[model samples]
Target: MFIQSQPADPAIHDKALRIANETLFIIRCLMREEEWGDYLREAYIIARRILEEKP
Candidate 1:
């Protein structure tokens, strides 16, 4: 959804996805399952809001 707002920019899309994945990986490695769940949910909310924002 976030990529859809951009003008066919693969670099931006790739970077955003990379960041999201890296964040998830780090959280998984460093956090307890219960605590990480909340952080993961918050990350998803932030991503969703970014996608929902108007240009």
Candidate 2:
């Protein structure tokens, strides 16, 4: 038998989206740093993707 998945919780989903936005903001600030700029750029892309996705 196939298992069914529960519907997405709005609270949790909102919280996750908020966190992703915050992460993207922080990453954006750090991306300007000379040493870690490259790595932070990649991280920013990932966070941005998470923020853009729907539940």
lDDT: which candidate is best? 1
Q: What is the C-alpha lDDT of each candidate?
A: 0.61, 0.51
- Candidate 2 lDDT, tens digit per residue, 1-55? 1112433356644655565566666666655557454554455445445644676
Q: Model 2 lDDT vs. the true structure?
A: 0.51
- How close is each model in CA RMSD to the real structure? 5.9, 9.6
- The TM-score, computed over Cα atoms with residue i paired to residue i, of candidate 2 is 0.40
Q: What TM-score against the true fold does each predicted structure earn?
A: 0.50, 0.40
Model 1 TM-score (2 dp): 0.50
